[model samples]
Target: MTAAATTHQHTNCLRCGRKLTSTKSTATGYGPTCTRKVKAAAKAEIVATYKPHLVAKAEELIEQGGIVALRGRNVFQVVASNGVDTYKAARQGCTCAAGLKGKHVCYHRIAAHILSLAA
Candidate 1:
């Protein structure tokens, strides 16, 4: 299904217990009505942790590697020396247990995504 369709079917904000519509509607991972609350929380957390350089790198990696193909197997068919490979989210989330527990992006995957974007 399309991302919009999938997001529409989503029941709850992944970041909060509020209800949600589509991922596009709730792009920040919060329900439409409570988006601000989620953003505040996220902002506070980001400020409390991680450096600016690390955050930049993670963003870069995501830009390059976030969108994986439907190949159904390899993270990337061909890996460049400067590129780092990562697994597609089996269920639209980080594979790391910690990430799942905290309901946040995993550091490893974030790092990879940031690096990819930088490249």
Candidate 2:
């Protein structure tokens, strides 16, 4: 019997399947061009996929500075409609009802994600 650690080698780009020659590319998995395209597509997806009204609401939330990133924490405080309650939104999940139930994508999570990308 033996205990050993195994290391996996990445020989191709995760994005385009191109052979990885550079150490930086191998470490990151995604090539330089794909990385840029991925970042651009993320912002575009935020605008294109979500409902127009929801996007507007999310933008308005950002404008009000309601989405605050907690220092040293990976969570953001999304201001509630009542202005009293707080919804803690993580990178892709939120504490709001909609987020919990997964019925619809709440504006709180969207606001948090938008702010995260901006930072």
The residue ranges of model 2 lying beyond 4 angstroms of the native Cα positions read 1-43, 71-73
In candidate 2, which residue pairs get closer than 3 Å at backbone N, Cα or C atoms, i.e. clash? none
Q: What would the per-residue lDDT of candidate 2 be over residues 3-102, giving only the tens digit for each residue? A: 2111224576544557878766655554677556545544676777788788778766654445556743357777776666788987578898889998
In model 2, the Cα lDDT at residue 70 comes to 77
Best by lDDT: 2
All candidates: TM-score: 0.32, 0.59
Per-residue lDDT of candidate 1, residues 1-119 (tens digit)? 24542333335543334566565544443455444542343345543566665455443332223333233322322222234443443223454464467555554444433223222
Candidate 2 overall Cα lDDT vs. reference?
A: 0.64
Candidate 1 residue 31 C-alpha distance from true site, Å: 0.7
